[model samples]
Target: MSKGGDGKLADAAYRTVLEKILSHELPGGSVIQERKLAEAMGVSRTPMRDALGRLEGEGLLVRLTDRLLSVRVITLQDYLHSLDVRMMIEPQAAGLAVRSLTPNDISMLRSELAALEADESPQLEGRHWRFDDLLHELLAEKSGNPFLSKLIREMRRYTKIFERQTVPPRRKPGLDDHGRILDALATGRAEKARDAMAEHIRNVRKRILDGL
Candidate 1:
């Protein structure tokens, strides 16, 4: 195959493996066998290896030995620390993003959340995660400062890995918090947006702590 074809395969492999990790299908500390994974995924070793390397570079995978790799195990402490960092940064990101985000963007996300709330299916967990991603990613991307945006995105990615380890995410509370955030942003007040975002993160931390 051409170099372009190889790159496409590698990209595909990367996304598939990353999704598995994020979805907890391959939970923390799960061993990754390159050859077996490649075979199971019906992809070439080269692409699978490349994908694993990328995930490792991103700190999602750790090299256990020269011949072994495993998913990074995020502890409860690590999750709390990540949340603390997010609490510091994401509110500021939301405040900054309020002016940049369009009405349509807010409306689209609101619609998605409403749909998820209305649906009573078992598949709601995945949709909740997707909506969460959409809301945070939009805020990060639109945050005026690129450095802040990058930090928020990275912190969120870490928190997400930790969040899915617990089955059936806190859906109702989370959706309600998101609604408050959207309402604050819609009012075009930076302070309100910041407060709403901070409260949302605090609520998340509280819910997790309460569960323990």
Candidate 2:
């Protein structure tokens, strides 16, 4: 394969492994045998190793005894730690993003909020997470600071992968929180947007701890 093709394959391999982990296809504590996985995935060993190494760096995989590797069983503590980081940065992110947010940005966020409200698939839990992430992603990207945006993206990635939906079909408070955040942004109240975002994150943390 050409150099570019090799790089693409490595990226594809990485995404494949990440999807498996997020979907729990490779459950926590399941061994990650690179050779076997490489053969099964029909990818080169180098790329497979690269993917595994990336996952390990992301705390999704741990190198065990004798070079063994297994998925990291995410704990409530890990969840809260990630949330704690978000609480500190993301609220300020909303405040900063206010200056940069255009009417178009507000409209786009409103549309997402509307879609989230309409989403009622009880069994398709992953759908909710995608929307939830989308809502947060907009704030992170529009927050007017590339580094902060990148940090928020990184912090939220783990939460997205480990998050489980509330079964038995309950309404997500995030839907309303997101709406309120959007409202604050629409009305050009930076501090209100900031506070709303902070409150939303706090409510999320409470839900997670209560679930635990």
Candidate 3:
């Protein structure tokens, strides 16, 4: 059994279940059978229940009637709302990062960008998601506001569904946008960074709408 920071088995089970949900291993809208998940993860019902409750709180799962847990579906409305929130949050974060970013931070970002560029393996798609997460997380950290970083991290959970659903053709354009934002940051041009981030998110919004 997995343990929490307090070394409780329930914490580990919660993390395991959350990983599966976020990685799309569970897929959206699929009914979650607690007993089955507990058995599959080699945990007991109590720990699994604790994990499920946490997942539900994070909007990764929903509890239905009869104590059924289902993966939360990402509706178009949800996607748009998330994009709106990101547009409001990330560009400002980028602007703040421009003022506070260190050489080391830029170097780390450059490394991530190189990895993104060199990723040709089919299995590396997941790495792309992690790269995006890291980029935003870095920006949040550079913003130097713990509360803002926490909020951004929470909002980021909603983005994975859109990323997974819209990867193949849109990925390059997304990377190009990321490059522009990075360039703006490197030059210490806060306005440019903000605009670049907004443009990138707008493009994503358009792509998602185009698909639907």
Strongest candidate by TM-score: 1
**2 against 3, candidate with superior lDDT:** 3
Clash pairs of candidate 3? Answer: none
Query: Per-residue CA lDDT of candidate 3, range 1-212, in tens?
Result: 65454336678888887667668787788899899988987878888888788888888888788678798887767777888898898899888889898778888888888888887877576777777888888898888888888878877777767456444434434788888878888989889889999999898788767776
Distance (Å) between predicted and true CA of 13, model 2?
1.4
TM-score of each: 0.93, 0.86, 0.86
lDDT of 2 by residue, 1-212 (tens): 45587677788899999888877788777899899889988998988988888889878899897678998877766767888899999999988878888998788767766776777777445666666777687878878789999889877866655564222334655677778888888878889989999988988777766765
List the candidate numbers ranked by TM-score, top first: 1, 3, 2
Candidate 3's clash total is 0
Q: Can you tell me which runs of candidate 1 are displaced by over 4 Å?
A: 1-3, 167-171
Superposed on all Cα atoms, model 1 deviates from the true structure by an RMSD in Å of: 2.2
Query: lDDT (CA) for every model shown?
Result: 0.88, 0.79, 0.80
Better by lDDT, candidate 2 or 1: 1
> Against the hidden true structure, what lDDT does model 3 obtain?
0.80
lDDT tens digits by residue: candidate 1, 1-212: 45687788899999999999989999998999899889988999999999999999988999999989999998888889999999999999999998888989889988998898897887888888888889998898899788888788777777888878863465455888999999998998999999999999999998888887
Candidates 1 and 3 compared: the better one by TM-score is 1
